[model samples]
Target chain A: MKQLTVELGERSYPIYVGEGLLNDIAATLGKHRIGTKSPLLLVTDEQVAKHYLERVKGLLEAGGYKVATAVVASGEKSKSLSVLEDIITVALEAGLDRNSAVLALGGGVVGDLAGFVAASYMRGVRFVQIPTTILAHDSSVGGKVAVNHRLAKNVIGAFHQPEFVLYDIATLKSLPDREVRAGLSELVKEGFILDREFVEWCDANAEKLLALDSAALEHALYIGCGVKAKVVSEDEKEGGLRAILNLGHTIGHALEAVAGYGELLHGEAIAIGMVGAARLSAKLGNPASIASETERILRQFGLPVRIPRHLDTDAIMGAMMHDKKFTEGSMVFIIPKDIGEVEINRSVSSVWVREVVDSLKEGE
Target chain B: MKQLTVELGERSYPIYVGEGLLNDIAATLGKHRIGTKSPLLLVTDEQVAKHYLERVKGLLEAGGYKVATAVVASGEKSKSLSVLEDIITVALEAGLDRNSAVLALGGGVVGDLAGFVAASYMRGVRFVQIPTTILAHDSSVGGKVAVNHRLAKNVIGAFHQPEFVLYDIATLKSLPDREVRAGLSELVKEGFILDREFVEWCDANAEKLLALDSAALEHALYIGCGVKAKVVSEDEKEGGLRAILNLGHTIGHALEAVAGYGELLHGEAIAIGMVGAARLSAKLGNPASIASETERILRQFGLPVRIPRHLDTDAIMGAMMHDKKFTEGSMVFIIPKDIGEVEINRSVSSVWVREVVDSLKEGE
Candidate 1:
């Protein structure tokens, strides 16, 4: 097992990524247990409920825990207020106290929503993440969890880290092609902003990854989670260095709003958003070669390199305006300075953004 | 103008209980601003919207900051996830970005709901509380914000401090009598747990307070907020000293759950809970005189000294099984050793509690 620490000071936690982590939870939680509460509330989305929920439940139960399950419907919609209420209610009914733990046992959505609930329930409770998908490699490591509200995605949530994250790559065997591809975006983002070798690794291993080869997937998950763990550790709450994790997310979130969430999985939107950022980087004359190569690698991975057909510049721009990166009226974009290097670029023009988005809408 | 500091090291924030804070928001947001984004989405319940919502809107707008409004139907229900969704959607539709601030402009309900939204939006954004009710005097000072979930109250939320709290005492005139009495419980709590003299002062002045006399009301709000400010500053996230703040909340929360939230205000439930805690403390030989004095004080102030007639002790006990304070099936109570000193008691027996609650029920 490889351990990566998210350095959030006293609020910091560790992310364990490797094969067979699900079984090692007892040992993982042993170090973090404050001995105040026992038993854990396992929070999973409906999709995850089928494959690994019972397995995790069994693990905790066999360890002498009175495990209670709070199964939320898996999707962006599950992050809403009513769902949160239901989850909290389940935990409470199950006799969860402040010392009791909440184990988030799904992908990004489950980790995020459940973590937020734990964060505020009784003014905060301990939580762990047993993430199942590749996309969760990033979400599980970062402490950000929330659901969409009327105005934006992740519009309501919190920045509370978990005590530990058990990222068992074996859990990804059931992941669909699209979901796997979606997870790659965060890896791609980690590489783009923090590490260059990981980007090159992705470029060379795209085919191996597309085939879902165990070795390639493991390597990707490790490196992806590694980069994420490094950045999040440095700046847990996106104070500064943490913002780098949001490389493609500024535009990616806008695309989600314009296209409607679930129209394109978050990774798909971010993949395309990265493309837009790459083009913007080129337009701004920062690192044309790196931008081109990055776009080339994403296209090979079967991730969308362009915005969807129906989404136009106006709607995308409108979404961008709502992003926290938006300053006055301009939105901040992360653009690659070199193949493995990225920089936060805040000077892109709206006219240029519209042009690129419109071009991408017309299928690249 | 009164400036209260909640001194929880990194999580420390100032509570500016004054009018015209909305006018100088820049000064308030001076240090925490990560970027130049100044536009904000003001979230308020209906009750506050009619009074000072536009005034705050005008202030921010006049400060050259673009402002958007997200209003939910007022009351406790507004803190529910459903209402958060509506507000978040409005923020999304209005183009709220990560740097954009969330202004919670109402009572504890709106502050908690909106603060939770602000805590999670874009992994987190800045939020300001412009409290318009007496209850907010307590809620706004702490970083705690949440919505009710099933099985418990405040089952979903976060410990995210607002960028600033603009507590215009002038706004409390519109508050109802019930809310005022309900909020007084907090002040009474501070005295019972941390300052016995403060509690005596409250018992002496509660009548002037009920009349909303300016001096009495101001003093009450100040001392109440001051006690919270001192405790929160020491333990922002309830790791230790912060638990004292919840002296009455644990049993109060159970009462709220069993009594049905709408049946009793938070302060009222806390009122009843405080009485129960005092009884427990007295039985444990911590302070027998204190318990009787507390009951006398609450009764004299027109607060309930007994559990609701329609409530069930078993159910309340069952509900508290979910309080974050419970560890290993043990309920922890923050009970007073004397009039001015509080201790976190973890070894309280359930049998004793049941008997006390049983006896209290019989008397009622």
Candidate 2:
């Protein structure tokens, strides 16, 4: 097992990465002092619940904790206010209290929804993140929990850190090939943001990561969560430095919005957006190879690096206008300067962004 | 104007209490460095908008802000997830960004609903409080923003502080007689918590306050907000000492829940809850005068010190079981030691609480 802590002072918590850690989930929660007397609500998706819900519940129950389960539909649509309300109903029914902890036991969607439930439940309670998908490596750690609006993605949210994140890689063995590749897009994004060596390592071990090799998966996730923890620790509220983590998110979120969320996975959309940002980087006089390299590495992992031709460019641009990054009449882009480092450019032109979106639709 | 700060270090903000402060709302927003370039959303209910929304919007526009207005139906019902979604839809349609500020322009209901919209927009945005009712002096200052679930009041909420609290006593002139008395229930609640002299002063000046004397209104609100500011500054997240502020809130919230929120104004519910707490204190070996004095003071202000006989006691007790205060099989009550002093008793028996509830239905 490998562990890293997101150092957020009193809000700080650890990320545990390993295979078969679910068997000892009870001990990890106890170590973190997660609510034993107050009832715990374990929120997961229908997909995840079918696989591990009963085992995890039994483990927690045997550890002397009373637990209730809320199973949401398994998709992006589950990240809505209505669904959040349904989960809160379960929480209220379960008799959860101020000291009660909410345990999220699925991928990014479950993690984001459950975390927001915890953040807003009685003005915030303890939260535990148990990420089952690779893409959750990004969303689960930063405390940026939210639900998407019809007009935009993650438009309604909060910065509520978890008590701890328990990553059991044995769960990832159940993910399909497409989901695995999509998840890798964000894993490699960690390297693209601050670690050139990690990016190279991801490129070298792409095949192994795709095959769910335990050793490679553990190492990459530890480093990915480390980068997220480091950036978030320094800028928890995204006043300045934290914007770098949104490197591909500005364009990526717009794509998700235009595609109506369910059409493309969050990681696939970000992969395309990362490429667009790299291309924009080159348009602003950075190395052209950065764009080519971002595209190459993403494609190597079987991820889509191009926007689907059928999606209208104008609709995508319209969605960007509503993004958190679009402030003061200018687009904000996290442009890659090189393989490992990025810069937060607050004045990227819409015309330039439009051209990049148009270009991503072309053949290669 | 009398001003004081809720000293939350980086999240600290000022609370300004006076008459007709709404006319200079833009200048005060500018002083606080709230967004000018970013669009602002002014949220009010139908009742408040009829009087102040147009004027506040005009003032903001005259000061160079792009303002959008959302007027919810005027009542406790506005504090629901469905209504919150409606406001977010309005926020989206208005193109509100991360830098934009949400200005709540009514009493506690509008403040809570709008403040929550700000707290959740883009994982949180800047928020400003423009309180137009006497009861708002308590709700607006503490940063306890929320939308109620069908099951409980404030069960879904967050602790998102504002840029500043702009209290205009001039607006209180338009309130109905019952509302004025109800608002006073909370104003004197501050006195009941930590200030014997202030409680005595409120008892003496009740007629002046109810008659809308500007000097009495301003003085009372300033001191009331001061007590709240002092408590919140010490414990921002209610770790320990802050629970004292829940002096009557546990029962108050349950009463609101049982009454379906709209039947009883928040202050009225809290007034009854306060009397019940004092009675509970006496049962737990405190002076009997504490209960009698509390009921007398609340009666002088024309507030209800007894629960309506029509409401079921079982229903109210059930609601308390679902409150944030009820944890680990024990009822948490903030009991009075004297007319102006209280203690947080976490292990109060539900049997005692039931007897007090039963007792409250009988006499004045």
Candidate 3:
């Protein structure tokens, strides 16, 4: 097992990366003094609950913890105010208190939804993340928990960090091919924003990683979580350095909102968004080769490189205008300077945004 | 003007107590660097909007702000999750961004609802409190923002402190007689739990305070807010010291939940809860004089001293058992030791609870 600690002073927690760690949840959580006597709420979605709920519950119950389960419908729709209200009601009905801890056991949707549930339950409670998918490697570690509104994604949320994140590579075996590719998009994002050599490593090991080989997946996730952990520790509230993590997210979130959440997976939209950002960077005088490289890498991962033909460019622009990241009326975009470098620019012209988005339209 | 600061380190903010400060909204907000160019969302209720919305908007606009308004329906129902969703959607439609500020321009409901909105919008933003009711003297300063769930009051919430709290006694002139008495209940609670002298003062000047005399109300709010500010500064998240501040809240919240929210105003329910706590404290070996004194003071302020006959004891106990403060199935109660001292007792027997609650029932 490899462990990395996200140093956030009193809020610091560890991320455990290894194969078969799910079975050892009790022991790992115990190391952090999360005892069997503590009331535990195990939140998962239908899909993940079907596959691993009992197994995980049994392990904790065997360790003397009384586990109460709340299984939400699986998908982005679960990240809504109404769904959050239901989770709170369920948690209260289960007799969970401020001393109780919530264990989120699923993909990013479950993690985000459950994390917010824990965040607002009694003004905040300790929660652990047992991520079931690769995409959650990003969401679970950063502690950016939220529920979506009808008009926007993550419009209502908080920056509540988890007690710890426990990642078991064995769970990756159950994910579908599309899910695996979605997870890699974030791992690739970590590399693109911080470590150049890490991107190169992912490019070389794509096949082994895609196969869900324990060793390759563990190494990729460890590196990905490490970059994220470091960034979050430095800027927990995104006052400055943390905004870099939103490199493709500005356009990416706009895409998700325009496409209607769940229609386009977060990672898939971000894959296309990263491409859009790269094109904008190239137009703004970054080397053309870097933009091509981003496109090439996304395509290699089976991720989309262009905006979907059905999406309206004008609608996408309108969506971008409402993004929470926008301050006043001006929009900020994270432009890639090169494969391993990026710059935050608020000076991107709308003419350039329109031009690049127009260029990606169908039959152009 | 009288001012008290809630010292929360980097989250510290001031509570300004006076008459006619609402007219000075622009100057005060500007002092905090909430500039004219910053986007502003003025949230109020239908009733408050009818009287103060345009006035507040005009003041902010005159100070250079581009203001937008979201008027929610008046009453506790506005604190529902659906109402929260509607507010967020309206704020987004109004083009609020990360740099924008939400000014809650009414009583406790608007403060709690809008504070949560600012807390969750874009992960958090600066919000100012323009509390127009006396009850807000308690709610606005502490930053305990939340929207209620169907099953529980403040069951879903966060402790997001505001930038500043501006209390203008002038607005209290328009409140109904019942609302004025309701606000005083919290003020008396502050005195009962923390300052015996303040309670005596409230007793001496009950008529003036009840009449909403500027001098009396300002003094009462200042002292009330000072005690609250001190307690909150000592314990921000209710880890220990803060629970004392919930002196009347455990049972009070239960009352609200059982009464179906709007049926009982928050302070009125708490007035009864404080009496119950005093009775419980006396039964637990405190002097009988304390209980009598509590009943006397509540009666002096036109506050209810007993649970309504129609309220089912079993239902209220059921709600209390689910309070967020419970730990390991043991309920903790803030029992008043004397006029100005309280003890947190976790060993109160359920049998004793039943007896005390039954004693408060009519025809007993």
lDDT of each: 0.77, 0.91, 0.88
Docking class of 3: high
Residues B1-364 of candidate 3: C-alpha lDDT, one tens digit per residue: 9998999999899999888888888889889888766578899999999889988899888888888888999998898788888888878898888878899999999999999999998788889999998888888988899887777778788998899999888999999998899899999999888899999999999999998889999899999999999999999988788888888887888888898887788999998888888888988999989989998988998988788899999999998887777788787899999998888998888888788888877676
- Point out the worst 10-residue segment of candidate 2 chain B by lDDT: B355-364
Give me the runs in candidate 2 sitting further than 4 Å from their true place. A362-364, B362-364
The sequence of per-residue lDDT tens digits that candidate 2 reaches over residues B136-196 is 9989987899998888888888999999999988999999888999899999999999999
Per-residue error (Å), model 3, residue B158: 0.3
Q: What is the lDDT of residue B153 in candidate 2?
A: 83
Evaluate model 2: give its TM-score: 0.98
Best by lDDT: 2
* Global CA lDDT computed for model 1: 0.77
Model 3, range A10-126, lDDT digits (tens) per residue?
899999899888888988778878776657999999999889999999999998888888899999999988888888877888778777889999999999999999988878888
Give the deviation of candidate 2 from the true structure as CA RMSD: 1.3
lDDT per residue, candidate 1, B204-269, as tens digits?
787887787877766777777898888877777778788887877877888878876678888888
Native A-B interface contacts kept, per candidate: 0.80, 0.89, 0.87
